[model samples]
Target: MTISTTRKLVGVSAAAGLILALAGCGAAPTSNPTGSSGGPTAAASFKPCIVSDSGGFNDHSFNEAALTGMQEAAKQLNVQFRQVTSKSASDYTPNMQALVAGGCTYIVSVGFNLSAATIASAKANPKIDYAIVDDPADANNDGKTDAPNIKPLLFDTAQAAYLGGYAAAAWSDAHGTDKVGTFGGMQIPPVTIYMDGFVDGVNKFNADKHKKVQTFGWNVATQKGSFTGAFQANDTAKQTAQGILNQGTDVILPVGGPIYLSAAAAIRDSSKGTVMLGVDSDFVLADPSVKDIVLVSIMKRIDVAVHDAVMAGASGKFDPTTYIGTLKNGGVGLSPFHDFASKLPAGLTDELKSLQQQIIDGKIVVQSKATPKAATSN
Candidate 1:
């Protein structure tokens, strides 16, 4: 959570001085002032903009985390920034284009759904820097990423999801039920990637503990799973959660944006002692109302990545190289068990920590073909 104050000051000073100089002339400010004090006044023209996926900015998962990062960057770096939310897939391009037309120096597009739009925008405007989450911006729809202006902020979430799955299995075992499950908002790579790792982790737990833990929603072999059709459909998500719970699942991971809210509501209403796992951001921190039902979260650290990207762009150190979040670099990992930590079986937490290190050291490989590949070279 520590940010470099010197770096922040540097960016702020330059941007602030530009604003002051412009103010000295007859030109009016282009955007609202950041209202930062003492250090320097940020230039209204050096705005950073963000376009959310269909889930909007308050999805309480992926989109919210990214928006949080942008807000942090705006505050710490003393930059003016704005955001546009997308209500549907059709809104992606138009939202991004609006930000581009608004004269954003750096445009961050949240989620894989915006990949095509981001790639097209980056290609059309090479002068503006773009950062996209989830997808690598494979312009041709090929597996390889070739866009030089689009920086892909991806996560090896499988690493963290594996830890979460193991923890969930142990929790279920302690509860005397060997059933756990996971579902997604879509069958896309980002969503399936979490399910893949969760399944593997459960399988690993079964092998290590000699337990017959069963996962209900996702089938790793066939790459098929239950999905709510879209990220924002709480009713469908609730129905899906109820179905999984009916199958005796004591723990469930919902790998969608705000869909976790639906899962939380289901777990709460059922009153069956069932727990839920979260994705993208830590649910306990992001949605405290659901903390009682949330066991742990597979954190993608999207906010940190987005904040750092903004810092880099503001300081003129923007690199086109893709940023891959992994357990090795603190980019992606498991969140604290919170209220459930003390309730966990003895030695379970230690085992998860050891597994994390093992994965980082390459002793274990949390791989899934669904994982989006980072560019070998920028």
Candidate 2:
């Protein structure tokens, strides 16, 4: 609808810089982002372009899920779609420019790393519709996104994570374990919310059980934990998992996507009786063998959210505020208790459902911190 840009030096050596410069001048082609309820792009003519983060498409995780959404939108809306993969942050903005220059409409960025690059490009070219997943760009200190043209897709994982924590706690206790742990892709909200809700859920379960169950990694109240620096680095995550095990935590949860897969592998090797919980996607989907041992999963509905966003873009209605994923909204939640279903007391499942409703109904608030009530002096 609007195309705006300031003189930006697209260094001569930048990837396809000359092509992008030309893209800034003319109308880009666009197609329906599959399932676009809004009819058709104004141009009735542009293709959708999406850029992937370093993890690449088919990660069976975030990137893969997002790509599916794009492809779905493309197919449903009767449009063409193309995606660029960036191996590093430097490629972010240039990739945006390249797509814009290529005369593709609606350039979409796949992850938080693309925030700045996407924003820069959005500000410069008002005509190109840009969408980013997981991070909202907040130019003002008010903690809200100031960009009217930029669309951000976000998730409130803490809510579902709490349920996941409860599930994990229940699984561990039923199996005769008491200690657990967690980690994240980074210390940012996109990832940490899972750890926070998870810790809160476990703490509540322990409090109700009146038993001291120790957990490491995420401190719900403080909203912090150890991060693996990046989500794609499996080796570091595996090491982190091993370290958690060394500290005596048997149930480990890591919320950093593929990185947690490595953590799962590490836990499978050296724990006395460790159970690994997954995040983002169902671990059982990744490995059915792990299904037999999976305690629970802190599920994020990235697939649905991304698909919805693409549909919205095609329809021409975009909301830039954070899209928090919750149990009520089905944005995030615990997966069905697959293998562990038979192992849990029947009443336990009812209790968890009741707790989930309490959370949704605002009766129980899972504090983002683990502060066990101090022992009373007898």
Candidate 3:
């Protein structure tokens, strides 16, 4: 019934190596799971829980992806699960404590904002197993997990964003604007990593094509740029988007949860046909309303990572080793162009494929100061 006893059953199920299929935003199962959902019902004591950041569970982005994974795992395990949403920074500790008080055995913290609370909760309640998405759970700069019970679900999104940036540059070049822009919700590592890769991707495009394509809203060397200050669809996010658009950028990549919605609005209102790139989840599929304007999305398979972590815990194989998602392992990738496939320049798709293989083959190395390195076991 405890995590200690669960470890004896580790890797007993073949489902441990199951491959995750790509999923978009859909009506997930209710937070409460019933046996009728499907699969073998786990022990009643095997409870898996999740806590969302300020964006809530339906932000059509990172939080939503993590929530969807937890829901699917609970359904497959056929056990009841709990989820709490934090409306602000102050809500993290209380939300985590609520789940602990509710007897959650496995906890998934949905974003970097919940890192401190998740670590503290794990240390205080050594019996519970924990996983944190998009954060390494290293409170000190020691390069090791602060809590042995906490697992880190991280993604190297810079690799995928580089590809998206290249595509954005190609789109802009074909449109004759030869300019792209990117903005984030905040200046955190998770958000800036995308900007770093995107700007580098644009630079790569310029080098390959012998053309000059300017990138706005972010400067990789200085590591400074415009941010909306929060991951919300607000006037500030819209205005930030407009500022980038005013720079004559033909394409824009918005790196935040729901803030992309604000960018889409800015693009629509401008009537200049400025395309955009999505971060976290596939915006075109996650939110069909933006399908017309989204050229591509830099995807981080958070759902897959979360599902694997929960399943591992359910089977008592809760290893705290850091799980780093990269292009080689299908952890991060670019979503299908969908509506923009035909609109891109000729041979761009082939060029992207070549570049992807090169990155995988180590022919091209994408560097970002914010890039996450897998934690070494202490």
Candidate 4:
């Protein structure tokens, strides 16, 4: 008996619709249908495959999430998984093609950087099912890819960031240093989504309370300005954090992926109320010494996503086009505050929870360019 239920978590939400169209019902089958580390027992009928971005498989961010998802599917569906980690952008085409050539029934390209290559690879082979983890090509925003077989996973991170940002801004108001800062890995929409959401959350929090908290690299009215590209540089991130620190910005939100390490380091060493907000994976543990200086984090559920996609292909449910992961569906959310729950507000936490429910229920919309025009704003 196959049982499925869409659990709408109040604080959680990805791409199930698109994948359902690609695999069809006849792809593969296995006795053990839910993966749990037993390894694949059968080859099944359809095989699922994934090609990593230049960050490789263990970047502790998107790539890692994808791997976790695929592995889960492999165990549960008893389907074969072919995974290739790319060392550089040049490896995208070759790695993607290698999976296609290996008779993969479905192929997933891990990031937006692989969009062009996924397109060419899909067009060349008309029968294969293809997918991209972030950003869809075609530049038309027309809900169509260059190839009919490809599917895209686009996340509405603006919602998640809103919660995170709201928490950050409120934290500042109570502990009033009158300033905050932000930076991210890249300027691409995927990266920008985090920045945009962060700005929106901060603005909303301030607006509700009627305060003018000066922001570094952020303006909610026009939605612009941020700093330090790349998630790998410690020095640059440190310098950026230090600048915000000098400006009396006690809270520093750095969406710089793993580079948040630098920001945490600076916050811990500082004497003032200096603190850090993280993105993607939790940086609280990334540097436990800075636990006191750590704030909140915005998260994307990439691990579960990869696992489900691979399982979809194996289960014969792959569909093309874009798969949207939003708050209502349990694909994105805000991480716990860990040790900082002490200085946090009890009443504000309840308000954030209410906002999350309202946003997901169509009763309220957290401002985002990606959101549908019809959704009401909070």
Q: All candidates' lDDT scores?
A: 0.78, 0.65, 0.83, 0.65
Regions of candidate 4 where Cα sits further than 4 Å from its true position: 1-45, 220-223, 269-273, 283-293, 370-378
Off by over 4 Å in 3: 1-41
TM-score of 4: 0.81
Assess the local accuracy of residue 138 in candidate 4 as a C-alpha lDDT between 0 and 100. 55
Whole-model lDDT, candidate 1? 0.78
The candidate that wins on TM-score is 3
- Which should have the higher TM-score, number 1 or number 3? 3
- RMSD (CA, Å), candidate 3 to true, equals 5.4
Estimate the TM-score for candidate 2. 0.81
For each of the candidates, give the backbone clash count.
1, 22, 1, 19
RMSD of each: 8.9, 13.0, 5.4, 7.1
Give per-residue CA lDDT, model 4, range 267-330, as digits (tens). Answer: 7677776777766555454345556677766766655555555655554566553556666665
Per-residue lDDT of candidate 3, residues 35-109 (tens digit): 554444566689999999998998999999898888777877877799999999999999999999999999999
Best-matching candidate per lDDT: 3
- Give all TM-scores, in the order shown: 0.88, 0.81, 0.90, 0.81
User: Candidate 4's error at 90, in angstroms?
Assistant: 3.1
Instruction: Summing lDDT over every window of 10 consecutive residues in candidate 2, give the lowest-scoring window.
Output: 2-11
Off by over 4 Å in 2: 1-43, 221-224, 286-289, 319-322, 366-378
